[model samples]
Target: MSQLVVEWDRLNHEIEEMTALVGKKDAEMALLKAQLAKAQTEGPGTEEVKELRVKNAALLS
Candidate 1:
């Protein structure tokens, strides 16, 4: 019937909108994950901390 057709069309439109939103969110998540990984890799390490402490002590002396 015509009513059923109308309902089906509305549902399909909603589904398409939701699919697009999901895709956008997925892309954002991937970008955030890559940024997090880069940050972790570029952050200071244990040796760097130790050197900084020695420099601080020398400065104090």
Candidate 2:
């Protein structure tokens, strides 16, 4: 009976540790998704880069 109680406690502890790790991973994933969305909205894109290259080439010519 004592051994069964110990085993139950050990399993409960393992479950708690795994749950905490899962929560941490979820938070990190959310942060990365937010950063990607912000960057997509704010940064230089392909069309802008192409335009800049054309202007630079014209100026050099």
Candidate 3:
């Protein structure tokens, strides 16, 4: 019975650790997605920005 209790405790601890790890990973993924969206909106490179500006100027013309 004591041995069973010890095994159960070990299993419970493992589950809690896994749960915390999963939560951390989820938060990290969310942060990465937000960063990607921001980067996309901001235009990632000089060429992309220049292209967008040129397109805007052409449209205005």
lDDT of 2 at 25: 100
Clashes of 2: 0
Superposed model 2: Cα runs more than 4 Å off: none
For residue 4, model 1's alpha carbon misses the true position, in angstroms, by 0.8
Give a tens-digit lDDT track for model 2, residues 8-28.
999999999999999999999
Candidate 1 on 1-61: residue-level lDDT in tens? Answer: 9999999999999999999999999999999999999988998888998999999999999
TM-score of each: 0.76, 0.85, 0.71
Sort every candidate by lDDT, greatest first. 2, 1, 3
Please tell me which model should have the higher TM-score, number 2 or number 3: 2
Report the C-alpha lDDT of model 3 over 1-61, residue by residue, as the tens digit.
9999999999999999999999999999999999999988886588877999999999999
Lowest summed lDDT window (length 10), candidate 2: 40-49
Each candidate's root-mean-square deviation in Å? Answer: 2.1, 1.3, 6.2
Candidate 3 ranges with C-alpha deviation above 4 Å: 44-61
Candidate 1: residue 7 Cα off by (Å): 0.6
Which regions of candidate 1 fall more than 4 Å away from where they truly are? Answer: 50-61
Cα RMSD for candidate 3? 6.2
